[model samples]
Target chain A: MSQFAPPVVKIEGITKVFGQGETAVHALRGVSLEIEQGEFVAIMGASGSGKTTLMNILGCLDIPTEGDYWIRNLNVADLDEEQLSVVRSQLIGFVFQSFNLIPRTSAAQNVELPLAYQGVSLSERRKRALAALESVGLGDRGRHEPQELSGGQQQRVAIARALVTNPAMVLADEPTGALDTQSTKEILELLHKINAMGSTVIVITHEEEVARAARRMIRLRDGQVVEDTKWVA
Target chain B: MGGLGLREVWRFAARGITANRMRSSLTVLGVLIGVSSVIVLTAVGNGSALAVKQGIEKLGTNSILVMSSGGAGRFSRSSNSNAKGLTIADAKALNDPATAPDVKMAAPILNASGTCTYGNLSSTPQNITGTWASYFEASNSPIDKGYYWSNDDVVAGRPVVIIGTTVATDLFGTDSPLNEVIRCKGQSVTVVGVMKSKGSTGGFQDADSIVIAPITFVQRSMSGYGSLSQIQVEATNASTTTAAMDEVTTIMSAQHKIKAGANADYRVLNQASILASSTTSSHTLTVLLAAIAAISLLVGGIGITNIMLVSVTERTREIGIRKAIGAPKSAILTQFLIEAMLLSLMGGISGVALGVGISHFTVLGVKPVVSLTSVLLAFIVSALVGLIFGGWPANRAASLRPIEALRYE
Candidate 1:
């Protein structure tokens, strides 16, 4: 545990396999990485190269078959499902590629969903959700249903939801994948602005433009990291 | 989220209910069919039984009847017409002070199935009884058209008779039947009076029927002199009936002079005991009906379980989303549990209402229905059905693995 320089994500020798015996798929093979707090990193890989697998492990939605992972200095790989849920809620925010908003719910309601599990009072949850929407610059549009909102506004509402719980980082899985060119740029700018505000950001995407927006990049092929690049300088 | 209380469960349940209103209505319909059958069948049985019981009670539940044991129904074990029966001697002996002065009254009845004719008004072979005027008092036969005979009419062995209301109305058209002559088996017997419509007494039709004349007159002029039907006795009240029966029995045993322990040559039956037993048998029948309907309830419960399991499958992604956002397994369990209870409670309430409605049709104009208990019972059983049948699927929903659920296609 280190103060003032908390390593937001740490993984060592993570490996994952699917199936058994003669028909095994080695989705991840001894992958290892680390990122300090407030760093914006992008993970780029082709289809079937296990990027989603690693993302799942990093987000605590899954545990590695053979590795240890620490998120914000807490050992997560050893935690059980219930404990992982706690970490998922309080530490990591997620914005899926599909937006994955519950159908027919308004943006503010979606944002407040996470805080409902946190046992926050309704008024407090409303306030925080509104503040998060304002942070993402969609405060006035909180009541619009996901279908009514444009792709960019929808992703931002999802972002506001991810941010409302004050997580250590936001995991955006191709957050701008389905958006138009302008909406993608606007979302990428929002992610940059969010990173500048001191929360770590990790993005998984196949788009070169999306990867190029990150300060650091790690590339994977055939379940192994083939390249790591730092564009910070 | 902090509290799992009834209100929150109800809220969740309301959303589920509104989400699929038609399915809810149909499910409730299944329960309604089940509960309503239980209610209507029970009410019909009870109502018919009440009608029978009221008809019997009019003769007075305290009235003790004796009939030739040639037997009546399945339980008619002791006596039949083939056996020697109670005679006018028995009634005369019972009228003795030593035998049954407590037998406030006793009617030695001799019945013949015979047609009686008056001018053009000819009647079917109805029940023609031979007894003294006190038979009306003991048997609760009231005179609506005319008066019964005096003891002089009975003792002088006059050919006078007190006719039942049915007999008078059929032959004499309800005018004063007294002093009119009715031809029975070619002999003219004077009808001294008309009896009130006794209705039915203990399964015996009192209307379209007959009453009258001394047993001596019946024995001499109608059937053989020694042959008599059974004797009926009226006790002062219910409490003394047993005592009165005891005395009558002791006297009859002496009169018939039986070998030790051969079961009395005569049989005594209590009307109250019969009424009470009918009610008991009816209760048993109701339970059997309910048990049969309970099979439907069981099927309904299973339906609830199966639907919930499908819901778990359909909402796997939602469960994942909730768990991904920090919902505990307990919360998931409660949500599914609430859904199941909502389904069953809705079914029960509707079932109760439908059951009550069915009872109206079954009651067929009768009031003070038999289905109130059935309604309450249906609710409790439906609630239990939820706990029993919904339990496995609710637990299944609650115990889902969030990690895998998130990956579910």
Candidate 2:
């Protein structure tokens, strides 16, 4: 939104190696990136391109092995597991491709989970959860469990859950990977509307159509960024 | 750390348990069996112990019995050719205050069993004890109806008798037996007093099926005055019973010319010693029953652990989802731990109720006495079992990594 504001995410040359010795696999090799606030960006990569690893680090679910990662000026590497949990609850939201809603729980309750981890009171959590569901165009489906809902409806519930915390960024890992073409279009349009509301959005995907919906595109090849471009649609 | 309050955690735990109703109920049943058995078995042991105590106490706590070792024991009469029999003279010596200071009174009893008849009714009494009036006081048999025969009755060889409740009910029916003449062993005797009902003792010996008469009359009419059967000695008080026994034994051994520590012709039965030995045996039985029940409780605890482990494994994906949504480790831990605790605590409470209810009825002819200590102990132990057994699975659930959990199928 502004050129003067510092980037919401900044990472130095970061490397992530899984295991040790000669058997160790390098998932991320000295990659550097910055993502600004209010930017709807898509990170495109094939399987094993280190995109998922980078998303994990940015979401504070993990820390870099050899470099520093800062989320809103807080050094992620310096924070412990408990502080990382707080950051995830208060600052970041995640939407998985599988719509990982807890079984036997209502959609409204699922949306309220992040706020619950943030220690929100029950009444306040309910109000915010209802508002989030309303924004996701499923206000009346709040009480339905995931099993009772369609795949698209479950994904919408997950999206509502991601947005309920008013996080700094919403990281969707192939949000429409399991959806039909019609559901994908609807989900892409919802992401557009969410981005227009001045919230930063990141969609990680291997699909060209999904990446095409974002204003900015970053492509990864072999654990390193190969292309970065801005598209005016 | 502070997000999930105790109440919220409890609700979550309750929901988790209800989600798998069949499994949870089975686990609860296991704990219920363990706790209830602990209470029931211990109560049975306590009941038998109390029954024994009551039986011995009816014999009078301050009394001691000096019987001839020539017989099978105190209850039976079998001649042993090598041993000398107890006599009336030995009873008189125990009654002397200067030689046996702790002795309050002494009565010599000659037991004879015979059919008693009044009018056309007849009944065989288990014991027809012929003794002086002092036997009534020493043996704790109180007179329920008429007055006891005087000392003059013994000197004059009077045919006066006292009948037990069972004998009175048998020979006289509802009619009062006071001043009525009854034939016992072909000797006519006047019923002077009827002893109070003592009920059946230890479910074996019938204390209310006996007849009592003056020793001189029984000797003249039935058994000849060769030797007395047993000497019933009453101490000054319960605390001096051991002293009275020691004094009687010493005097009898000297009178019989038996050396110290040698095999005497007689045996002394102290009620206090019998009480202590019986109490000790019953205590052992109680401990044994409790120990066996504890093993079942331990198995129930193991059942909890097994069920919790299965729950953790089954809910791995769910745990992953919660962790991804920013649930702290402690919250997950608390949720699972509380679920296990609720199961066991429910079982324990229900077990207590069931056990107490069962104890109200007689089992194996022993009336159970429910001890408060066993109830409290069983409950506390059950709760601890839940906490301790649930710990491993809860920790396993909590320490799971968010990324790995989310990726879990």
Best by lDDT: 2
Cα deviation of A101 in candidate 1 (Å)?
1.3
Where in model 1 is the C-alpha error above 4 Å?
A: A1-6, A72-74, A228-233, B1-21, B68-84, B95-103, B142-145, B150-152, B158-181, B189-208, B363-368, B407-409
DockQ agreement of candidate 2 with the native complex: 0.50
Error of 1 at B23 (Å): 3.5
Worst 10 residues of 2 chain A by lDDT: A56-65
Badly placed stretches (over 4 Å) of model 2 are A1-7, A12-30, A62-68, A73-78, A138-141, A193-198, A231-233, B67-86, B96-103, B113-126, B143-147, B165-194, B236-269
Q: lDDT by residue for model 1 over B15-124, one digit each (tens)?
A: 55566677766766665666666666667666666766787687776688766554432123344433556767777888887667567777787776577889988765
TM-score of 2: 0.86
Check candidate 1 and list the clashing pairs.
B69-B79, B69-B80, B70-B79, B70-B80, B70-B81, B142-B196, B143-B196, B144-B196
Worst 10 residues of 1 chain A by lDDT: A1-10
| Residue B230 displacement (Å), model 1 | 1.1
How good is the docking of model 1, by CAPRI class? Answer: acceptable
- The superposed Cα distance between candidate 1 and the true structure at residue B130, in angstroms, equals 1.9
Q: List DockQ for all candidates.
A: 0.45, 0.50
The TM-scores, chain A only, for the candidates as listed are 0.95, 0.97
